[model samples]
Structure formats: structure tokens, C-alpha cells
Target: MLRPQGAASKKVSVPPALKSSRGVKSWKEAAAWLRARGIEDIECITPDLAGVARGKMMPSSKFTSNTSLALPSALYRHTISGDYPDETESFRYEARDSDLKLEPDLSTLSVVPWETDPTAQVICDVVDTDGESVPYAPRNVLKNIVALYAERGWKPVVAPEIEFYLVAMNDDPDYPLRPPKGRSGRSILGGQSYSIAGINEFDELIDDIYHFSEKQGLEIDTLIHEEGPAQLEINLRHGDPVALADQVFLFKRTIREAALKHGIYATFMAKPMQRQPGSAMHIHQSVIDEATGKNIFSNADGTPSQEFFHFIGGMQKYVPSSLVMLAPYVNSYRRLTPDMACPVNNAWGYDNRTTAFRVPLSDPQARRVENRLPSSDANPYLALASSLAAGYLGIKKEIEPTEPTAETANEGSIDLPRGLLEAVALLEGEPDFLEVFGKEFIGIYAGVKRGEFETFMQVISPWEREFLLLNV
Candidate 1:
């Protein structure tokens, strides 16, 4: 059992900002900051393709800027099931299986609030021996897209709305998960969208979430109950793409740890239960002029700008091809079905939830498009990169979007790929995404997904055994 410790579990008069090591630029400064906090261990980690934390844990005293930490280069080619793709022309295994160096990104350094021992964790960048970034690394792929915006003197700002479920613990893989009983000793029966009572049922766990987030320097915009039983949504404040992605990555870990402390499991699965609404990572995105610091989506007259429409045009044109990244898993397609509060078409509209892209009603400075297609299960880094890459392409090509559909987009024919294999094929054929995200990454990523899909095919579900055994 994990016990809460450190300043997070206890009251401290010192503000989190003063205690945080986020601003430190060098290892010497980071060491000073950790020492001040009496940190005993440091977790040097990086997000893999599936957003899984991978790297080394070491004593703080041994964690220097020059610490030679490295992971197998083939780690990037690993499937979520921990199996590597069969060697093929698309994904050839390196005979040497070289190592990729891990360099800490000091800005992400934060205290492990729930740890029994005083510990710190920092996100790392994967680099080769030459000190150049590994192109396929999830973080590096995002950096590549962000660099394109920087070259055009534009800064992309994004805020993600993450939705998840709190479910009862299930040790067996065959059994379906159910909502956990709250403080009232009863399980949630029906939808409780925005119900204060629903949130209060798990008040203690929610409080721990806030406490853990505060200690990690993550800014929470809001927390609200969603339509599903025990379903909750968290909105993060708008910020830089990489920074926000980092928060989303860490926030997942924080929420799961906090839930476990309460004897429940917090799942980010796109579709965790049957007949329940699927969870989504709705990303609200906009680009700003770096020089004027003005939202490029709105013109000087505060009216919608051409760039805004083109951005939507980009999404409409390219997002289908990028769906593999946004909806990465076989289960992810289960959530993309129509009339489930999930968008099946890449339609754009004004304050319309049915459309894939909704332009929310706000002041010109805050004008942005909310991409509703990404599943909660997606890797934050890759999701952001794919979404931004689509918009970048739209702007670069001046692609024009279709007329905004005020009617229900879910009523229309499904425009998205219906399965993982189909999505992979679409992504492989699209040259625009290939150029933006790199051909090497697309190849390895597609190959890994194909392997996972093959594995899934080998498994016989209960549905097949129950019905097919007697009928078919």
C-alpha cells in the first residue's frame, strides 16, 4: 500500500512556487533546489510512444547534468503490449541496438508529492550519441511541430480538457469494470453531469488530486462531473504546447496515484464501460503572433480572420490522416462511434458540440478551436503534435474548409476511419503528415500498430465464444 507523505499530505505555509524547482536551468541550480527540499531520489524519465514513463531512478546525489543515462534505441519501436514489431523493411531492428541518451528538461522538475520518501522527477529528452534528438521520440516529434510554428513567427497555444472515470478495482481481466462506491457507500446509478452531489461523493479523492497538482505546479482551470457515472473532466489552463503536454503527462500519474490512495482506479481509457459515454481529450487550440502577441485567428476588427478558417480547413483535410495518433489503439475506435457524445465526422461549427471542431464564443483575444476528436487514451505529446501539424498544413496550403454545419454532424455519414488498420493506411498514404512528423516516425509507429492489431486478432473475445459457439 502507498502512503501519502511530504509537504503535500501535510500543511505547509510556504507557497508551492517557492518550493518548486521549475525555473532552474542548470544541474547545479537544480541540485541546490533539490537539496533545499531535502530530496533523496530523482526520477529521470521520458514519455514513450504510448505516453508510458520510461527511464531510470537514482539517488539525487548521483543525478548530475552529466549523468550518462541511456535507454535502448529500439524502445521507441515497442508496442503498448511491450512486444516489438516483427522485423520488416519498414521497421528493421538495429543489429547493434544502440542506446539513446536521456537529457533532463529542468523546466519540468517537480516534487513527487505522494512519495513516502522525499523525491523529485523531471521529464527528459531522448538524444543520440551525437546529442541530436531522436526523431521518433514523442517529445521530439512535438518539438519539431512547434519549431515549424516558430519559424513562421507564430506561437501555438493549447489547453486540453481531459475526461476519465473512477472505477472499482478488478483483478481479473475477463470481468467488466464498474463504478466504485463513493463516501455514501453506494455506486453511481445514472448520469450526473455537473452535479455537485456527484463530485462530493468522491470529495476526499478530489482534494488529494488538487493537493498533488499544486505540489507539481500544474494549473487546473476547472473540474466538473460528466455525463457518465463517476466520469469527471479536468480543464488545464492554456499554455505552450510542450509545457501543457508535460502537465497532462504528469497529471495522469497524479490522478491515478490519488485514486489508488482511495482504493479506486482512475482510468483514461476512451471507452471503459458499455452504454457509457466515451472520454475525450478535447484540445482548445489557437496560434498567436509572437511579435504582436495577438491571436491570429481574429483580425484587427475582432472579426473571424482567414487564418482561422484555414486552420479549420487544415483540420478537415488532414486530421483524418492523423487519426492514428489521436486515436492510437484498437479500443480507441470504440469511442468514435456516432451519437455517443463523440464526433464521427471532421465537421467544424460555432459552439456546436456535434462537430469535430467547435469555435467557442469568446473575445477575439481568446478565440480558439476545440478539437473534439482525440481520445483520452492518446499520448499527450503525439496528440498535440498531430493536431498542430494538421493546422500548420492547412495554413501553409491555404486549404479552405467546408461550410460550418449547424445541424448534427453525427447524423452524417462517418468520415473517420472505422478501424486501426484503416487509420494506419490513411496515415501512411498522406505525404503532408509524413513531412511534418517525419517518414521514419510514421513508418515505425505504423508498423508497431500493425503488430498490435495482429495480436488482437489472435485473441477470441467472449462475444465470439458465447454466440458463435452455439449459433455460428
Candidate 2:
């Protein structure tokens, strides 16, 4: 099967100064480091509400930290379809469509491994002209939630298990997606969960994924075949919430580039195919007290702590309202169907996969909750923010969770919103989310989703044509 290529395959040589985990702290350091690598271009980018990279690319020679790069503040207001919602009284755009400054986060600088030219990409922070952070920006939204934890003398650690599918390249949107042909020259037909041979089918692409990740300093704890045809999952090692979110953001682009090189499409759609299993980005999260440097979920005697139950209580209480962020698109709800290995309700259990919140068996130090609600299609930054925000609220409010179930939680009443519009409404109605995510962000986010849902309702589906055409 696939073997690790170790040091020999890690071809990118990072400069000693740039090798620091804290990254290049200043513009001068960034410039010197880029020059040492003979970089030609620099991509200054930031994640928008939809997690789509939006920014400008410039020659490395011209990219100084003092670069006055800015994009329209309205970028965050656009939906997945690139349509902006009609301005409402509370959420009207600035009269001039004012520009927001792009402040490069020097720590996120990394090489664009697949580029023909020696180009580097850095994630930027969206700031107002006054240099204050844009509260609604996806990255900033995540940072705000992290900052809230820090204010409480706690730090949240998150490890995300991202699932996606490899599908054959299709140019037409009307056609159904098909499993890509592997090295065996045949398309995958059945589920191949944890099959070594199944993973071997696309050994070349997996190798490239590893190499691309290595070039960018992204870590992959494990990669395995999932239950659907050509579906795969990558588990990232747990660390800081922001750092892990950044890795997940970049990893999605890396996987897509690697798959394109192999003449296939790597899709993160929640449910790309009707019959196949849907993809999920399950987040394993735990909080540690900054003073004690120990997991807050466990007590001194290694028993489950009150904070742990409160966190779960928070998830159950707030996850439904936060579904707008975790499941943003109209198609995301397709993956939450019952009996599909997906949890339909917000139930918690020990080592249970069917529950929305699963507490895996582990040591006291490693004790964490796995939030199985987020779809693979979610923006990584918002997903982490929403999950952590709920838990933070739980700890603050001291909410008590329901009894953990040992049996299937899918059979329980569906505690989640069934559609994008419903989710948007729930999120809008929740005052706590408005406070946590900010009223401006919720307004923009809900407006965008409403616009997208309206656009979706305008289209006619094949199912409608086939069933209602004659019957009606």
C-alpha cells in the first residue's frame, strides 16, 4: 500500500529564521525570508464568509508589509452564488462600499507548492481603515471566539477529522457525480471503509497530498478510506483552535490541487451523490485551563468534571441555532438523514458514533467531545467558532445536559433544523448567538442565506419534473 516517504520526499527547505513555529513576526522578516527562497509572487488572501479565498496577488518585490492592499467590505455579504442580498434597514451596505485593509498574518505565510512559479501565499486579517479587526470576517470571527476563551483563562484545543470524496471530472452541472477510476482502471462500486487496498487505488494522489501538505507545514495524523466509494478522511493532530482551523482551510485547497493533478475532482460537498454516504468534518474539542495546563474536562482525580458536562450541555443548547454556520448550504441538510450513519439529534454518549456529541474513550488528559454536526462543506473557520462559542456559553451559563444515551441517537426526534432557511431563522432568533457572533455578522450571514435559499427556490428540479409533471 502507501508508504511514508520521510525526509527524502520533504523537498522544500524552509529558511532557519522562517522555520520558527511562531512564524515571521514582522514585514522585514517576511521580506527577507521570501527573498532567501527566491519567491516571485505573493498571494495575500483571507477567507470570506463562505471560506472562499479572496485577495490580491502581487510580485514578491512589491509585497512589503506596508502594502496598502484592500478589498470591498461587501465581499462578506455575497452568497455562495455570488449574489448579494437586497439591502435591509439593519444590514445596509456602506454608501461607498468602503474598502477594508488586508493585514497579512505573517505566521500563515507558506509556499504555493503546485504553482509553476516560486510563489508564496499568506492569510491576511481583514481590518477596517482604523486598523480594527472586521468582526464579521471568517478568520476574525474565529479569533474573537478564541479570545473569549483566553479572557476566561482557558484555551480550546481542536482536532478536525475532514471527510471528502474523489469524483470523476464532470464539466456539466446537470450530470450526476461518479466515482473516479483508481489505479485499477475501474470506478469504485461499493463501500470500502478502512480498506487498505481501496486506499492503494489512488496511491499516487495520496502521495502528492502528503508532499503538498509537507511543503506547507500541514500535519496529517492519519488518512483512511471511508464508507463511501472513493471517500476519504484525514485526521489532523489537535492543537490551538486558530492554527488547526488554518490548517484545515489550507488542507482543502491542497487536496483539491493534488486531485486536479491526478485528473480527478476532490469535492467537499456534504452529499455529492444521492446514494453514497455524506461527508462530515467532525471536530474533536477540549478546553485546557491556562493556569493549570490541564484539561478542564477532567478533575484532579481523573473523573469527568462539571465543566465537561456543561460543555456538552452548551452543545445541545446552542448547536441547533449555530446550524446556519455548520450547515450553510441548501444541500447540507441532505446528509443529516436518519439511518445514514449521521446523527439526526443532539444526543451525547460515550464512544457512540450515532450521537451528535460523542465522547470517545481516552485518558483523562485527552478527554474531549467530538462534534459530529458540521458538514465537510462548512467553512472551517466558522465551524470551529460556532462549536467553541456554544461550549463557552455552556461553561458560562452552567447548563446541564440530558442523560447520555448508549443506544442510537438517530431514532430520537430530530433536534436540528431541516433546511437552510429554517437554520437561518433559528440563528437569527437566538439572542445569545447574536451576542457571541455579533449582530452585524448574523444579519449579513442570515441575509446571504436567505438570498441563496430564494435563488434555490427559483430553480426547478428533475424530481419535480418527473413526479409532478404527469401526476399534477
Clashes of each: 0, 0
Q: Per-residue lDDT of 1-472 in model 2, one digit per residue for the tens?
A: 5656663554776567666433587787888878777889999988988888899999998897466999998898887899888987556777899999998888999899999999999999999999999999999999999999999999999999999999999999888999999999999876799999999999999999999999888999999999999999999999999899899989999999999999999999999999778999999999999999999999999999999999999999999989989998999999989967999899999999999999999999999999999999999999999999999999999999999989877885788999998998899989998668999888888888888998899899889999999999
All candidates' lDDT scores? 0.93, 0.92
- Evaluated with lDDT, which candidate comes out highest? 1
For residues 364-416, could you state the per-residue lDDT of candidate 1 as single tens digits? Answer: 99999999999999999999999999999999999999999998889968999
Model 1 stretches with alpha carbons more than 4 Å out: 1-18
Q: How far is candidate 1 from the true structure (C-alpha RMSD, Å)?
A: 5.8
Using Cα atoms with residue i matched to residue i, what is each candidate's TM-score against the true structure? 0.96, 0.96
